[model samples]
Target: MPDETTDTTAVAEQRIAALAAAHPWVSEARLTPDGVLLVTPHPRATAALPTPGPLVGEHLAHWEEVYEWTYETAEGRHAGDLDLSGWRASDTGEPLPTAHMRDWVDRTVGLVLAQGPNRLLELGCGTGLLAHRLAPRLEGYVGTDVAAVAVDRLSGAGLPRAAFVRAAAHETETPPVRQAMEQVFGAGVRPDCVLLNSVTQCFPDLAYLSAFLHSALTVVEDGGTVIVGDIRHAGLLEDHFGRVERARDPEAADADIAARVASAVAEDRELSFAPAAVQRILAAHSRTVRMSVHARTMAYDSELTRYRYDLVLHVGPAPGTAAVSETRQLPWPGRGSEPLAVLLRKALSAGPVVLHGIPNALLTDAPDAVTPHDLRQALTGTDAAVLLDAGDPRMLAVAAPADRATAATARSLRAPVGRLAHEPLPAFVQRRLPEVLRDHLRRTQPGTVLPRIVVDDAPKGAVR
Candidate 1:
């Protein structure tokens, strides 16, 4: 293989060409003078979903490509002052406000500092976003990533009490990482806090996350905290897609929007988890650790504030570190129930309120769910219909009856939309609307910040 470190124009074009081939949606790919490979997708590719959104595989091969490309772009564009945070605005594909990104960094720094850790370990450090901010404050810091570029760059940065390693998340206990950690902290010592921030979404699945956590908890100090930050919320998966679809085309018909949303959700390669899912996974280690969920406090109404959250795993049973308890419970509004605005106002006055099953507002007005009959009607003149009759495996699973499915089939039948061939549609009304509504409430109700924080004790019984 050619040297991965240096990329000539031809090499860059070849790499992008291969990536584009894997992604049929890509219409144009070009390398900028600065070495960033910019890809432009076909206009209708999202609705069409000709192929999966991005490449995903073991050890986050896809993310490695992305970060390598991103690092080059940031290095060229920003030069001496590099913002390695990777927080970008979607509309323009530029980095979001620096202050907003720093707000999150500051908050995370405070959380890790509050633990008073002598040593800190960050998995998927991604060019030292947190390492640069935290390395000076701690006695020892070890940052790891799959990207050699990041590790090599950070290694030369000469940050005090910091070591950079090229390792995957699950490789925490491996020889390379262990040697690096030993050099920083000392022999036989573990980090007081292990952080994986804005990185879990790149994880392949829940199994990968679980495996990483198992390794993380084992390597951290007994009373240390494992902070997992900027997690994409699984419960808001649909809402996230819906927002994207609407933003892509504000005037798109509901049917078109619905179709594209389904396609985007299906093709999404990033891993997301409901707070409950993460909590359940943490349960296995509950006997020793307490789990707490926190919402991003970023002032902007972007993806981070809208769909992402944070988790802090307090390792070992410390005397005063009990789980957060909900002080009140409130039912969300229905057709006949009190207005959502009013209910939220009431809930705000009540401290630490737990809102139950809030319906997703975006889907509230979405097209009806797809039934077999609806599918048969919608697919009447389409190629998908012929495939369905021929029992194409992709067409077999029609959306509608399944709670998670929507009119994915119907949407595809009408347009170039390709999302319906696999997954089915759920009820138009669903409990997936909390995060968006939270944003709405924030805008409509001044001084009303609903805490999306989730606090729960570890499962009833779990081993380390």
Candidate 2:
């Protein structure tokens, strides 16, 4: 049998090494007096590491190498049992290394503080960097990851306010992780915000990635927000920075490397969005979509990169309600009075007024452009109105030789008017205009001519 004391020491060292590998910033991790491991000398000691290549197809083989050793090593396997919560202080005796990690924790903390303390669930809460940072500002915080070792470490760290769940990526069936998530968040709890920071790109493919995204949405409450940040295909350093190689012909080698790197980035990597694919998927499930890109330096890379994030705000309508109308129009400028207003008033006074307008360019632009206030003022006294919406042909057909008086009377209204061309009017209005006017005149006993005068006292039978 293996020597127990020696094996234990070896196991401890191996576990520490695995953690350091998985978490780049972790320099040294030792078991504390309380069984918690203290990580010392943060990863920032060295200049930023080169960005990794894309995780796609053949490139995935290279990418796997970066994580497998750290994840599968002997120490890494047993790290699940080591707890860090009981440790009073880190071996480094320094504050958490914020510089090397993404600033999302700070941003999230600020958002929670401003919006009132909210329950937060951070998926892929690596090393609990963001969880620890946001715990104080949240009513409850739960973090879930596939790494059992990380869960054990978090438990030992004494973060009573935050709970950890060991769930593998794309493995929702994992019982330990699922149960832990439900216990802290509560069966009824739906996240107000679901944060996916530099996490989505790690998936094996877009199909897997989208499935997780949908799951995240399902867990978020209606009217909640999903914040996703980080640039896809951002790990390609050779493409980002030109390489200088010494060769028989230095210039030629440099050119060749540049060409190769460019080709590699172009062929092996691309953003996760597939044309209008994301929009199409979100439309069916989400109510509103807001997206923006901010240029920032990566905490680990220190190189300038564009951070693209999309916030899908849920806004489903009330049950049984029809879809809201979506009509937007800017008020017309330079039109002072509105004909609709005057027509409404006239209709209210005399039972209903017929509004006439020519379809000429001037008229087309006039009434429709009038301000709402002006239109309201014009219609203030009217009870009901009908728009003549007449083109030039319709206007000409209605304004007959005998109807000149009526046309002149309509022209005198303070509303904007358009000149009509000489043409026969549309049959519908031509047939209805006379009947409308006749009824109005008979009811109000105004003058009988087309432009009937609004006479206070007129013989009722004069026009008849």
Candidate 3:
């Protein structure tokens, strides 16, 4: 077998030579984009140059560094010789031929096709996995990346259905690439769908990610969809399992194991987002936004790996619309919000209710507020009850002392009034609001009933 260092040096030399041949302007190459050192006639003159838009030049600089690292240099060895293969294999996995990432790419492509594809642009199109999978189903496909090597590789692979462009994430705002998009697709050639799968999380900052999103919106047609599949946050996994296993010691271990696997896969990088935050950012560009998580686990090298990606589907206005109106509304549950909550309460009444917004805080004001204990008491006796927030008068009816005996005594006081104290306000309101009003109408008028509740004006200072 060839010595690892010798093999790596040969590979690096070839890569450096290739990069130099392609981009003659590059002077000194670093390992990453941030480390790229461009040689100019005057160092001060280069510093005085106008700031480039987004991070185009920065991305190019990183590409140069990656190129240099691939070369056999006397100073330092390239980690890519080991890191790239390891990362690629870890991402795609062995025996799969492609990386484990292909599974996610396939899933995302299926989603895009289901949405109805006219044209599509995939940002950070690493290896063109998505574009290749989706090209056959779409009218046109374009994939762009910061690395010229990726573009050349995809092109050489004969992905004739899709065109590969060497453009950085920040360069979409500039000419050339933007102009090429306009000329190829015509004036209003916004892609019907834009796929950002496991891509945005790679960005070091939210500003870069937001800028990419903003630029993407310009080429995305109204009523188009943006599909984002990436890890958002790691703490969410801890919170999720911690709450689920609080009661049983045996079950807690399983939760702990799962959390560890999730943390390992994510590597503590903040990639996941609360559903509400996803909604807020997407809402500005689309009329209706929907998000769902497809959770799965894989075993590799005797280690369990957990994969969960938040899939956001942003829908623009239908073909004919006078205007696209944006509104702040409750996030719609994957199924139905109200029904899901009601069923959960009925099945697991004692369990702590965990609420998370679609992205951040788009669904409800108190995204993480646990159901109050008073409401839980009200829910025990009756099939359901009206749920109210902290300020509602109904809340006053259930507020009791924290002691078990005191709470029991308070429950006794409300029993004669046909009210119970254990039900959650949100859960009760979700389940019984309609039925309660309907029954009230039957008693008020024997034969006819009003379609919806009608509240008479309350006197000034009267509690609702």
Candidate 4:
């Protein structure tokens, strides 16, 4: 008789190849001698994948369909889904070190209860993990998610005081929130606590967060606490990545990071947010907000991990109260107006520069923190310019349009640099401009064109 393991491998490989061939998105597939089958999705087809069910609106592009499909297809084996072991696995992000998640969860439960909430609403509560851990302790509890599977499976599985619903955070007045409110206070009362735990990433932008907040406030009683927990902040991304890189030996760090990336790819999930932007939006909207750094946002971790923030939004505080952490935008020139101007001014301050470095520097502190306004700011001012050789648009990440910056709107930047003068450059500029502005003066030879910045090139005798 043939061995069971050998037969299983042969069957698995055949299924993999067959599936790859059948899927319209699968661009290529190949099997290695070791029985490992590799499959690649067509780039465009993969990008166009949308949510499975009817959405609130077609306009909610990124959040509406992107998350719907992502969560629905997520396998139980993926980190943060149903994999308790993977929750503290090595080579991933965690609040404390992987070993300390038990303590973290316990502490989080304690902190949440400390708010003295009688009836609570939990948004984005994955797999009812917290409910399993704390439902018996609560008077009444409710959970919600965008994934229908999670809702259908756990809707009635919780304690007598608990229930689950399929709902999207960005949707206006979701049924879950209404049902949750009813469960807690019959038909006439609001929830004492509305917990948005590890759910901010599901939102596409700050506007959606603001919308969600408004909706939550409408259904929440006065003095009710809206807890935004387990926020994966990008402000400390570099610092955290640096630490994770240092924990393992050099080779191990590289391999570990590679493994982490592979896992993210497999799950079709990616989550990142800039703490600064989050603070700014919250400050402009909520009067009182308290941020606590705790809990593992990413689920997995290396030996050491850092960089997730838990925030409490005190909807309506008592007589004398203020935000625990009040954030304000910097008073930098051209501050709120345009991003292109700000980017150029900052980049040129460092002398001759590259357009890519400006946005990259801005992101060093917070991923996706640079908004449309910031990108517009960089292109609004003409203080200086960057030089670079034009190549494939893909090579210049900015040229490819996405949700962040509208690259097509900045088409003027693609013009030959020599003909371009003091007109406001786009958020990004690329030409082989020399290190110094004087590089242009040297290119006086016939048919020789060079790109360079013009820092007050007006005849010195003509103006001050």
The lDDT per prediction is 0.56, 0.38, 0.40, 0.44
- Estimate candidate 4's alpha-carbon lDDT, on a 0 to 1 scale: 0.44
Residues forming the 10-long window of minimal summed lDDT in candidate 2: 455-464
Report lDDT (Cα) of residue 230, candidate 3.
51
Q: What would the per-residue lDDT of candidate 3 be over residues 1-464, giving only the tens digit for each residue?
A: 87998786556544433333233222232223332222211121112123322222333354445543432231221222111221232323432323343444454565467567777777667655566667667677777776666666666766544676777665665675665556545665667777776555444333344455656666667767666655443324443333323433355567576766555433433233333334345556534433333221222221112223334354543333222121111211332345435643543343222211222221124433322222333344533221211111111111111111112112222222211111111122222333433454356445642333221211111000
TM-score of each: 0.59, 0.42, 0.44, 0.46
lDDT of 2 by residue, 190-253 (tens): 6676665555544433443455556666666665655554434232234233321222234666
TM-score, cand. 1: 0.59
Misplaced by over 4 Å in model 4 are 1-99, 243-271, 274-276, 286-305, 319-464
Q: Comparing 1 and 3 by lDDT, which wins? A: 1
Per-residue lDDT over 175-258 for candidate 1, one digit per residue giving the tens place of the 0 to 100 score:
999999999999998898999988877765555566688889889988788988887766566677788778779998999988
Candidate 2 residue runs with Cα over 4 Å from true position: 1-117, 171-178, 233-254, 266-277, 286-301, 304-464
* Model 2 clashes, total count: 22
Ranking by lDDT: 1, 4, 3, 2
Better of 2 and 3 by lDDT: 3
User: Model 2 residue 323 lDDT?
Assistant: 19
